[model samples]
Target: MVDFTFNAKEQEIIREIRREGLVLRKYARYYDEHEEELPPDEFPEAKEFAHIDKMAADRGADATSPTAFYMCMLMHRTWGDMMRMKVPFTALGNASVTAAGTDEQKKRWAKTRLSMANTEPGCGSDSKAIETTAELDGDEWVLNGEKIFVTTGIRAEGSVIWATIDKSAGRGGIKAFVVMKGTPGFELVKKEKKMGIRSSDTAAFVLKNCRVPKENLLGMDPTVKKGGGGFKGLMKTFNLTRPGVAAMGIGNIMACQEFVAEEMAKEGVAVDYEAGQHKRSAIQQKMIELEAELEAATLCTLRAGWLADKGKPNNLEASVSKQKGGDISRRGAQLALEILGAMGSTHDQLVEKWFRDARITDIYEGTGEIQRLVIARELLNYTSKDLT
Candidate 1:
């Protein structure tokens, strides 16, 4: 029930990003018409905060609320949708450095944004089931396997890959590594033509005997005989990034609400705008519910981010927020599309794209099913090893 009070500066920042969103929307249409118009990188101011250490410190020092930091990142990413395919990789890379990388690793990757190409073919949702192998060879680790559905894999300056060091040990055996671009055996094998968020790149990577250094190991925890370290570190990254994904869902919901409201207005629908009186249009009613749900989900996301920033555990809340946000996003988009009728199906209207974009929210970060599983696991006092 808590509301975020955006001061004048924050309000201006939000308005600027929304205005920028309009520009990105135009470019999205351009990309739809001419695929080549999509660029590998379209620089945005968000890149300036790509360094997690400083950004984290600044947030802490300024006594800025976690809600503000999350909001800033959300706005930055949303505006970066001008080059969606590129920004995701940058964000992923930035996240990896903060969550898993060593001080040295962080410094080295500080300047360049990297993408996480973790999921692979047949891997489904189990990151521990990854087939990518990283075998120690003298001073270096040799990696070999194919990574599928890597967001930004095609154009990443570098990648943080989650692969198994020992398949026999299962999930615990997984480890993450920082793989720089142009590593001899690391190649972008394919890029998926996505249904929505077309501007964002989704790619597959083929690592054939790719050599990465021992120094590239990310987890601060030392590997144990019980297969510790890797997946735990990856989960930390997820805890932080998943909320950002949820925020994206919230953004999609906001877009849907806006579309639905406009459509209702065009039809000469009128509803009370008073503080206590609820709106009456079917679509408007749905929007109101979605907005309330989004507000709650947004709070969860901000709390998760706050916990992460404070180094507190928040597995349950994070999953709940993601699940709620993703579900609301899909529903809000569906409602918007239904209100728009046939026009919703057309590419000319952004509602169709919003619906498509909302679907990805449910699938990525963690599937709604996966989020439920995680929530239940946490509620039941289950450990990572128990479910995996």
Candidate 2:
């Protein structure tokens, strides 16, 4: 046993997440404790994601430091607590609220709210294709469209939804709105049963004539700015949370490595030495490579996270971290399966579940493809025009 312990500040937040995570797990268990059996559809999972999301938001609503937030993530990984995703997801929402919300708006909806951006159904990668619409109606904003794959939308008391204020403006015309739940037209239609991170829930929502007060608009009105009027605003959250997502990936990497190593020992194999020196087996060599990859992935993710802590804008670094972490996760799952042979494929062992869950990290947030594009853009000095 690692017997991991945190420093004072870290411990405080860790305790908070652990306590809250327990509450969340109990709640989730009520509906379905069998995380492996949930359907990855769109409705119920969304609702489940929503519930955990709220609890996480509440945990951090009063924290004074970002390090505390980071500690929450570490505690989650250490405990193998998937419900801690809510902490980062909620932090993402808070970033947006802090950047764009009015004082009053922040007070009412943001103090403990969970907001989301990135990942849509048709175009999770392309922010330009967001079909959600927000039209100014008198003193209220009327929203209409469907958002599929909202991580915490199912249970969030409110959300800061991104929508296009001007269709002709394209990405430039998009704006964020702080919409409340049960606002007449906002409906959580489904929840998803995910492959990994089974404890966390994902959702799809429909907005039909969902009316929110005009004061809920994030950033200035679209007509007041040019070129994705609020993109810069939304980017704030991404910059802050993406590294944390990379951290989550790192956690998964560490988990797989630990599990594999432990299992290998039980099978009468010492994983610390090269395969050839012992059994001289090709399978052993493959396992060695998997362990090495896990190490590299862990370092990459930690490096990016450390940079963020240093007050640096490390978008490229963050993308690299996530890309490497995602790759390592996939490879780790494959290697674990091979180590266990036939039994590895069984969901009863959790290796299979981890493998399935690892796939989502590459697809969500900015996707592996998007991360590559981002890295290329940064290295090549490419302007926004080069994105297409």
Best by TM-score: 1
Worst 10 residues of 1 by lDDT: 80-89
- Backbone clash count for every predicted candidate, in the order shown: 2, 16
What are the per-residue Cα lDDT tens digits for candidate 1 across 95-126? Answer: 87787788877887887768887778868687
lDDT tens digits, residues 1-388, model 2? 1112334555554555455444443333323337534333233224534444344444433332344245346525433533333333354567778766667766765456575644567767888788888888888889988887777665566667888877777777778887677789988887777655655657777889999887778754646357555776676666666666666665655666667778878888765473345665666677677767766665565556566666777778778877876676677667777777877776456556656666766776787788888888888989568764
True lDDT of residue 116, candidate 2: 69
In model 1, state the lDDT of residue 49: 34
TM-score of 1: 0.86
Stretches of model 2 off by over 4 angstroms after superposition: 1-91, 102-107, 117-121, 220-224, 272-284
lDDT, model 2 = 0.64
> What is the lDDT of every predicted structure here?
0.71, 0.64
Residue 128 in model 1: lDDT: 69
